[model samples]
Each structure stands twice: as C-alpha cells, then as structure tokens.
Target: MKVTRLLGSGVELADGSRIAAGTVIWTGGMRASALTEQGSGQRDPLGRLHVALDLSVTGAAHVYAAGDVTLAATDDHGNHAMMACQHAIDMGRYAGHNVAADLLGLPTMPYQQPFYVTCLDLGGAGAVYTEGWHREVKLTGADPARSVVA
Candidate 1:
C-alpha cells in the first residue's frame, strides 16, 4: 500500500518513492500529524513543553466525573475501559429517566448494559466487533468472517 507519513512539511522517505523539490503533487497515507494546538500553532502552548498526559488508571477509577468531565479509566471493576458511546447511552437513559421519576415520585429506571455488543469504527480502515466490555477485539478485513450467511 502507498503511504505518506508527513511528520513535517519536509518530505523524506527512508524507502519507496521520494518526491522532488519541483514535483507538482505528492500523496501518501497520513496517520497522526504533529499534535499542534489550534491558535497556538505549536505542539506545546508556551515555550515550556508540558510533555505527555499522565494516565493513572487506578486513581481514575475511584474518582467519578459527570457531564463534560469524563476521563479514561484503565481498570474499573477489573476491566480498564473507555468512557465511550456505550457508557454515554447508558448514562443518558439513566439520568433522564431518573430525573423524570424524581419529579413525579415514580420509579427510576435502572441503567445497566451488562450484556451488549460493540462496534468500533477504526477510522473507516475497518471495525472490530467485540463481546462484553472489550473482552475480544477482532478486525473485519477483506474476508470479514469465515462462515457465509444463509
């Protein structure tokens, strides 16, 4: 597959085709460009580089966040998991129904996604279908699956 990793404006290929200075156009697969913040126009905000994000999964579990304060927890309940869409859907349902019940003194709906499936859009490259809370991650490539549907 033809891929172009553009780390910088300067193009250099360790192997494969390399474009010339006067080349009209160039193309390649772009993964992650340098993490430059918007407006700042630099990888770091100020002259002092803050460095990488310290992800402490253990500490994250004990601390709970709501609304826009969601963070990643690595090992909550023996499975370090994402605060993802699945969790969002569950949270929405629970929060909405609970609020409604509280207002009218009715029974609040319990929120639990104990048994469910996951569809991960791997950036249109492909997707992974998994059982449980990310227990198994499988890529559906060209073949997709072994058995043909009847």
Candidate 2:
C-alpha cells in the first residue's frame, strides 16, 4: 500500500492503482539512504545504522552518523530516535560536536533528547498538537492553527 505519488485529488499506489477523494493526508514513512549500506555497521530493519552514545557508527572507526541514517538512543527510558527532522536536527548537532571533539581529543557528549512533540496537520479540519512520546493531545481543531499563527 505504498504511495507512489499524490494526485491532485487523491493518491497513486505502488501497484499503479489510483484512488479518488476530496482530501488526502499523507504521513510518509522513512528509510535510510543507500549510502548507509556502504558502511560496515549494524543496521536496524529500516537500515538505520546502530550508533554509539557519541553518535559514532558502532563498528566503524572514526565514522559518525546522524539524522535519519543513525539509530541512537534518545533518552534513558529506552526511546530511540525517530527518522524525523525533530530528532535528526538534534542528532546532527550532536554528531557534529562529537566528531569535532573526537578529532580534538576532547570528551564527547552523549546524545539525548528527552522531550518530544508532534504537530500534525489535518488539512481543512485544522491540526492536532501532541506533546511527549506518549502523544498526549495538547490541542486540537482550530486551536492548533491559532497557536501556529500566533
């Protein structure tokens, strides 16, 4: 049921089937790029490289991975980083810092993002905003829209 393209009124599936509708909301999934295969490291089912606390590739020396390519622990509660910009941005920052720190012979900091939030657009119905990994709904309907504008 993979979506190959989003039509003006609907979506086209990978099987070449098309569905017509008035609205379509696509929350695409993520997968690591082919470049990750070139590295010698353990990969998750999604092909994300298993990374150390310092964001370094687990089995590759001096090589670091970040963003959607690496699967790093987000916190001590066993939550791993997702392949989203929210996690990727912070992962990139930590990876950059750790890489420089490694080269300079300085202690590198562990990557940690304890807080998580999600804002999902519902098209004409407005949006939904949630906080934390449990996804506790903080706002809905036009409230999320107003908050975004404000």
Candidate 3:
C-alpha cells in the first residue's frame, strides 16, 4: 500500500519490496480548479467551492463561482450542479448575470435549471436524444429529434 520509490523500470515499496512494471497510472477523484481557492468559502468533498442559489461564494460577497469551480444547486428539488458541459454553460450564464446585476445595483436572480438533456452519437447506430435527469430517450437514429439537432 506504500510506494517508496517509483522509477521508469520498476517500483519500490516501503517494506523493501520491488516490483518491475512497464508503466504506472494514477487515477483519483476530481478536484476543483485551483482558482476556487482564491475565495474564502466552503468546498465539497470533490473540492468544488460551495455557492448560494445565486451562485455567489458563501461568505464571500465579492466572490462568485460558476461552472466546474463551484458546487451549485441544479434545481429546486435539491439536485447538485454537474460538471458536464451543459451544466457548466448554465451556471456560467447565471454567474455572469448575477455579477453584472450586483455591479449595477440591480436585483440578482436565483439560478435554476430543472431540466436536462443530452444528445449522443452512437456511430453506426446513429444518435440519440435523451431528456431529463433520468435520460429518457425522446428520439433515436433518424428521428425528428436528430433533425432538430442538425
């Protein structure tokens, strides 16, 4: 469970053990971008900075986080924001809008996206269009949904 040395040829463990290997790959959980640490706020286990419904960093009025740097609510039902591209774009818009409003002394709107959708290409099987968090298929292959995407 412990690695004392790791060289291109092999690895050495703390117990004076050596194992020859071709390559070593390290896989671990995701962490938020280092930029998230610029603000003083809480973070989730994934290291994503916590934010309010408005996407403002908790306890940091001048700090706002969006996209993958933040842990934001995705809907009123309490789903957390995802790191996917669609969710990132959604959060980015809210963060920008709220920041502008704060600068202009205007009311800020709460960020919420109750619906989610995805379109995936299945190669020879064509593509599929799915809706909602459950990923219910609404269209497949050459269906009109595919046309809509086109």
* Every candidate's lDDT: 0.38, 0.90, 0.82
lDDT of 3 by residue, 18-101 (tens): 889987655544678887766668888778988888988999886778888889888877788787888899888989999999
Candidate 1, residue 142: CA error in Å? 4.1
Per-residue lDDT of candidate 2, residues 1-150 (tens digit):
888888898889999999998778655667899899997789999999999998989989889999998899999999999889899999999999999999999999999999998998766789999999999999999889779667
> CA shift at 48, candidate 1, in angstroms?
29
lDDT of 1 at 15: 75
Q: Of models 1 and 3, which has the larger lDDT?
A: 3
TM-score of each: 0.38, 0.87, 0.71
Candidate 1 lDDT, tens digit per residue, 1-150? 343544334445657555445323453322222322212322212221121112211222211122212232223344322335665455555555556665676865433445545664443365556667645755364232322111
Q: Pairing residues by index, what is the TM-score of model 3?
A: 0.71
Clashes of 1: 4
Query: Residue 149, candidate 2: how far off, in angstroms?
Result: 5.2
Error of 3 at 95 (Å): 1.2
